[model samples]
Target: MTPPPPAEPVAAMVRPASRYRDSKVNRDLLGVMKGTSIGYWALLGLCVLMVHVAGGIWVYQVYKGLGIAGYAHPVFWGAYIVTFVFWVGIAHAGTLISAILFLFRAKWRNSINRSAEAMTVFAVLTAAQFLGIHVGRMWKSYFILPYPNQRGLWINFKSPLMWDTFAISTYATISIVFLFIGLIPDLAIARDRARGFRKGLYAALSLGWQGTTNQWKAHNRTVLHLSGLATPLVLSVHSVVSWDFAVAIVPGWHSTIFAPYFVAGAIFSGFAMVLTVMIPVRRIFRLEAYITDYHFENMSRFILLTSIIVGYAYLAEFWTAWYSGVEAEQSAFWLRAFGPYWISSWVMIIFNGVLPHILWFKKVRTHVPTLFVLSVCINIGMWFERYVIIISGLSREYVPAVWGTFTISWAELGIVGGSFAFFSMFFLIFLKLFPIIAIAEVKEIAIHERAHAEEGAH
Candidate 1:
């Protein structure tokens, strides 16, 4: 048997130790090797100011009513629903990057896995806040749960809201667990370097991590298990979120394609949000070496591929409407393309599904400024896509008498603003407290790639 193909090469199984593990505190924080910049401080202050203004607006909404949000007769969902869906779409990227990429063994994901995972946690919090504010009777929102209430009614599992509660809760819990598990080894690193209260906090979080063989084995097993659990959740949570619209009988809302369509859109937009947040952060933290052009290019390639998928979904929806010859569906499709909400529809097409194609060029994808600009546009386009789907679709129905325009009042806009502010604040705090990049994973990948190269050379 030709000596069993030369014993399959020892280098194929394990890599040599790395210099990264030997580096000191300032030396090892590759992502934040450079100190925080002036821009970061500016962004934080701006975020705080915006949040204060937004909080004031929310208070105004409480004083008034849901009607203050432009929810006239038939347009009950308006901008809050649009923002809700938009934030949910934004939340998809973290799981996709961390769980999906980890499963696929995507090497380029090394640079982004930690920040992207954090984004998932923060985005979920942001989306949850919007839901809390959107539900006018916030305290009574508990009625949607299965707890014994004054009405003596259990949860309506049949309701999309209950499904959403389940999906979002599962998503948030899984994401947090995955994030903390990934942080343990890094926390131990911090614990070694820190003093006083920081040391205590890091030590407690680290759970006595000593980088032993068993600890590393257990850590890897835990990560593998969490990734397995989160993979299905990435699909199920978004599908359940889509059910909020798909299960409804409204003309535009009742579509068989909503589940997959919403999922595709979520991923497309979520990737955009990840890029939007990460680009500035990488720059602020001077993480150019860690988050390289290669990673950005890979991310852009994903964006381009997903943009095509979203475009295909868009075409399929219209084709089905025309093929079925359903007047309500046909009219809903037409209204999206040519009616009052057509602007948002067109913007969604041009920005989310179209503009990302520019990334197919190496120059565009690798260039920081271009990618940053495109990401911002894609994010805006995605928000408008949600607005078009929720508000425009709900604004009109079979009866013209109930047809009305959906407009966003300042209060509703403020809540959306506050959501961003809250998410940013949480993420900023997390960055200071934890390693913004998965140092252990990155080092592992780096070693693996090096070993693979040496083996190939042999």
Candidate 2:
């Protein structure tokens, strides 16, 4: 007997299977499009209000010089410096998960990669904002660049700030490229699904993609290429960021281990932010099917692994300090754990290093509420990690005369709070305006999953 004809195509089983219009994610996104949610509008307003508050303080700083925010004779770096490093550290997660996981072929990451990429973009924005704010002479900030000055001087590549400028700019550019590369297929789907202005906008963004074999092949190749290029840059970006501190002669700042340590911490915190943003968003968008528990569990495993690595780094630093018998190193470590910044130090240890072990239990790992709470704790803990490193380390330097406490002013608080609002508002708007999930990737995965199930049954 002749072999039975092949079963109906998966695409044929679901009419309009290739388009976003056929996707549950698309439908939910369309729901968000009808009108802005009250929460999102509230966040936007709050962010704007905070920006004004920060702007008012910034005006005072401009006129009165940098002393207004409490940088004293001894303390050159203060809350602004601490927050700048913290935000940059927090910015690491999305790109880490997306680029690293993608390279490793972690199928689980596919579900959350779109949101994670978006997070990377937003986190970088927050970091950039801190940079702008931290620079007191904001108007003449371009003076840092290696351009023709009034004296026609050249920028020294040896400068840490120059390295930072290069690294951050490179990283941000790569991040945006990676994000847009992944978004292209989704944009095509959005173009096919949308109407009127939305349709026109997505159509232009889609860049004439019709899902032809050649387009798919080229797009996939480009994504792979960019992801490969981005993976090393991700590590280098934060490593170079850490150099801004490590290159310094300051007692607490100079350490050979800082590059890897900071990169790990950045990845850990970045993942935490991704989860913090995604948990609520996944629920609101009704993307439970696409972003399944399996993905969350896999992500949790990474969180657990990273948490352990960071904990070890903490121990290693202490060990080196003890072994070296360096007075300043011992002082820095002791001050962090037992000094004025002790609360933040202990909080970091308990929340980031200790608490994440809860993931070892499958029940807690899969539970949404627990995961959400844990993500928030992880974020708080990561912030404290930065706090402990910056404030504790800086406040008790070798010269007791220069040692001073760092206090956060309202302006700094407002700006940081506004950054959160800024990230959330952009994400909320993104969900409505674009497909939240990678529609093509999900459809492809779903097809593969069904095929595997069918084969298993046979």
- How far off is residue 59 in model 1, in Å? 2.3
The clash numbers for all candidates, in the given order, read 0, 2
Clashing pairs in 2: 93-270, 93-271
lDDT of predicted model 1: 0.82
Write candidate 2's Cα lDDT for 1-458 as tens digits. 99999999787776664543465555554454556678777867776676667767777777887777766655656667666676677667767767777778877777788888887787787777767777768897787788887787888899988988888888878888888878888788778767899999988988988889998899878878888888888888888888888888666678898998888888888777777878887787567777888877877888898899998888887888878899988888878778888888899999989999999999988998899899899899987787777767767888887888877766667666666766776776777776666777777777887899999999
C-alpha TM-scores of all predictions? 0.91, 0.91
Ten-residue stretch with the least lDDT total in model 1: 17-26
Candidate 2 RMSD to the correct structure: 4.1
> How far in Å is the alpha carbon of 270 misplaced in model 2?
1.0
Report the Cα lDDT for candidate 2: 0.78
Residues 1-458, model 1: lDDT tens digits: 45555565766656544523555323556336235667667777787888888878877777787888777877787777777778778878888888888889887887788888898888887787777677778777777667877777687788899899999988989999988999898888777767788889989999989999999999888888898899889888889988998899887778888888888888888888888888987876668878888888888888898899888888887888788798988998899999998989999989977788888889899898999899999889988888888887788888888888877787777778877888898787787778988887777876777899999999
Model 2, C-alpha of 299: deviation from truth (Å)? 1.4
